[model samples]
Target: MRAVTVLGLEGSANKVGAGLVRDGQVLSNPRFLPGQTARHHRGCVLAVLREALQEAGLEPADVDCVAYTKGPGMGAPLVTVAVVARTLAQLWNKPLLGVNHCVGHIEMGRLITGAQNPTVLYVSGGNTQVIAYSEHRYRIFGETIDIAVGNCLDRFARVLKISNDPSPGYNIEQMAKKGQKLVELPYTVKGMDVSFSGILSHIEEVAHKMLASGECTPEDLCFSLQETLFAMLVEITERAMAHCGSQEALIVGGVGCNMRLQEMMRIMCAERGAKLFATDERFCIDNGAMIAQAGWEMFRTGQVTQLEDSWITQRYRTDEVEVTWRD
Candidate 1:
């Protein structure tokens, strides 16, 4: 069979990205969303598309299929990307493929790390999930019951008045490195599910009380928060690995780029005689290459979405989509 080319668009969160993949290789570097506002997402999408194509040395006519993240994201941004994708597909008379945001993360992680059949830990601003492949689907073994891990951290950063420039989580991670104290915070994990809302609330209260009493510093809070929460994440990921009888764990999504979390996960995996696979920030964070990679796989298997079926959704579940491309 000839190599198929897929142009992937991703605007699930604050990041709007575009990438092109041919066969199993990425043709161009991804373009990430620029601003926090949704007003520029449409323009970002178009700019990213044009840039990706230019970098790939290909035009719209060269793309065999068009794919965009369909759901489980902010509505306005998803709609913006979806509209562009639909328009492009119609204009080029090419096939349209609607990619799930989570699946894109997982598949992209697998591709970059080459971890076959590993349990996946997907953590981001909007999602925190522990997944394993079962039968014909990526089953959710564990997830956040309340706010996502990234959201918890982002909100806590706001409490500390940290800069959201670049990223709040990254700034918190840097601050935690200088921390000397470990403020005791709530660690709530029920079965395989974890809840961060209570922890976040408790930390906010602690931050306020510490500011009044000068007992605990922001560094301390950041340290304790990361240690406690990352422990929960590692614990749940370990459980998922054991339950699925897998020896490898793949970490994907924006938060997966944390060196602290990666080190913690590495220690746990080492103790269990397992391997941990993760990508750098370029691939771990939301990107179009992952979307394009997954889209190429689905497109090869005759999976395509019609114009009417390419609706954007805010609550699409990872387990809802069948893993038709994977055995």
Candidate 2:
């Protein structure tokens, strides 16, 4: 059998990631996305693809297939990349695979971790989920019923007027690194699912009061935020692991790139003698390569989406797809 090379494009939101993947190897990836602002993600996808192909020394024609994010993301951004991907697939006369963004994260973690059947904890601007692969499907054992963790952080950053260069989440992660005292913050965890709305509001109020008294530093606030939020996530993920009867953990999604969260998860997993697998920013955060990687696995299992199949779902349950992180 011939090895497959897929040119992938991702523009689900601010961070646009494009790459070339051949037989699961990320040959090259070039990213473009506004840190603090939204931009022409559609066009950016094209630029990323062009640059990635150049870096790989391969043309679009060299790829056997084209993979792009299908949906479960912002409407405008999702359409922006979808049209470009569909057009390229038509023009190049290649098979097109529209992959679920969340699933891509899980698959990438599997790629990097070699976790065949580990429980997954995915956190992103648009999602938070605890999942497992069983019965030929990625089952959602738990997830956020409210706002996503990264979105909560970004919105808080906006309130602080934090520069959105690189990424708002990255800024917050940096801020947390300098944090000292844990300001009193509410921790909300409902069963295996977690919520951040209350904590965001409470922290904003604390900032206002502390500034009024001129006694609080942003670092302390950042520390408190990361501490509280991460603890909540850890608690919930641990519960899900216990419920699912799995000790191995895999953290996915863009927010999974946060060092603090990774540390907390690592410590928790270590205590239980459960292993944890985490992909770095390349796979942890949103990227085109992960989508292409997941698409390749799906293709191998005869899970290809037909040409007429199209969906722009904002609330796609990750478990809806009947596939695991591995073939």
Candidate 3:
């Protein structure tokens, strides 16, 4: 079989990313943020696509297929990337593939880590899920009932007026390193599911009191927040591993890039004799490479989406996608 190149666009969140993949290899991945507002998704998508193509030293016609994140993201951003992808496919006369955003993260994690089959923990600003492959689907073993772990951290950063330049969560992680005290915060984990709304509320209240009294610093709050939320995530991921009877765990998404969280997960996995797999910030965060890799699998399996069927949705569940590439 001849080598096929795919251009993948991702705009599921604030970050707009473009990636080129050929024969299971990523040629280039670039991202852009037009502005802090969500209104710039379209412009950012176009810019990143250009940047990615330039970096890969390829033209639009060179791509054999066009793939994009289809759903389970912000409606506006998803539609923006979807429209661009569909238009590009029509113009280039390339096959179009619609990829599940969550599944993209999992597939990308597996691809980068070379994990055949592992329990997945996908944590991001918009999603938190413990998943495992079962019967041609990425079944959700557990998830957040309220906001995601990343969302909780982002909100906490906002409360402290942290800069959102690179990422609010990144700044919080840095501050957390200097924290010597661990403030008590609400930890809510109901069975396999976790809840962050209560924790967020309690933390915000604590932040206000701390600011007024000048007792606790932002570093302390950041530390406590990371410790509490990451611990909950690790606990749930461990439980999922035990239930699935899988010895390997793969962490994906934005929050998965946190060193503290990864360390905690590593400790938990070590205690249970399970291995943990995680990628760097490039693949773990919202990136187009993951989407391209997943789309390649679908494209190879004859999973193509017509323009009519290529629509954006915010509530597309991960389990709704059929894993045709997996046995």
**Which model scores highest in lDDT?**
1
How many angstroms is residue 121 displaced in model 1 relative to the true structure, after the best TM-score fit?
0.6
- Tens-digit lDDT track for model 3 on 1-327? 888888898988888899998878899998876575367876577778888999999998889889999989888888888999999999889989889999999988988899889999999999999999999999999999999988999988899999997899999999999998889988898999999999999888779888689788889889999999998888888898889899999999998999999999899989999899998999988999889999988888889988899998799899999899889
lDDT of 2 by residue, 1-327 (tens): 888788777777777888778887888878876543235684466678888889999977798877888878877777777778788888999888888888888877887788877888899898988888878788887777788999889988887788877788899889878877778889888887788999898887778778578676777787888898889888878887787778799999888888889899999999988988887887787888888888888776666555677545665668777774344
> How much RMSD separates candidate 2 from the native structure?
2.0
Candidate 1 segments exceeding 4 Å error = none
What's the ranking of the predictions by lDDT, best on top? 1, 3, 2
Clashes of each: 1, 2, 0
Lowest lDDT block of 10, candidate 1: 29-38
TM-score-wise, the better of 2 and 3 is: 3
Q: What C-alpha lDDT values do all the predictions have?
A: 0.91, 0.81, 0.90
Model 3 residue pairs with clashes:
none
Return the lDDT, model 2, position 108: 76
Best of the two (1, 2) by TM-score: 1
* Model 1 error, position 122 (Å): 0.6
lDDT of 2: 0.81
Of the two candidates 1 and 3, the one with more favorable TM-score, higher being better, is 1
